[model samples]
Target: MFYTYILASQRNGTLYTGSTDDLAKRVFEHKEKARAGFTAKYGVDKLVWFEAFEERENAFRRERRIKEWRRAWKLRLIEETNTDWRDLYDDLNNLLSY
Candidate 1:
């Protein structure tokens, strides 16, 4: 599956939108600060929102659109699904285990 995901530093903090085919690995890399970049610099490694797609192109397009949105809109999108802004990577792992 392909995915459109949002990572956040903290509640109301820095946010990033990205697309990947391997959601778990990508999020794990972010959490590990695998490379020097925006996510590493700002500690934006919390998986707060995500959507799965069958096609990578679809995920990429959604990610791009999300990135272009206003901060308030993005915050609202996260709050709509993740009111607590919790790290969803753990939950994803659990889901995969089932």
Candidate 2:
């Protein structure tokens, strides 16, 4: 599986969008500051939102679409599902144990 994900610094701060095949590992790397890029530099490690895709092309396209959206649009998207903008990493971790 592949995933398109959004990370945020805060409710109204910077946002980072990307796609990866290993969503859990990618998010973990970001949380650990393992990669030197936008997420690490901007401190956008909070996994605010994500969607899985069956194909790499679909994930990439969704990520690109999100990247081009306005901040308000992105906020609305997250708010729709995650009004609190909770760190989804913890939720994912719990789900994996089952």
Which candidate has the top score in TM-score?
1
Per-prediction TM-score to the true structure, in the order listed: 0.94, 0.92
The candidate maximizing lDDT is 1
Candidate 2: stretches off by over 4 Å? 94-98
Residues 1-84, model 1: lDDT tens digits:
889999999999999999999999999999999989999999999999998888999999999999899999999999999999
> Which pairs clash in the backbone of model 2?
none
Q: In model 2, what lDDT does residue 54 have?
A: 85
Enumerate clash totals for all models, in the order shown. Answer: 0, 0
lDDT of 2 by residue, 1-98 (tens): 88999999988788999999998999999999998998889899999898888899999999999889988999999999999988889889675444
Q: What is candidate 2's CA lDDT for residue 24?
A: 95
lDDT of 2 at 83: 93
> Model 1's lDDT to the true fold?
0.94
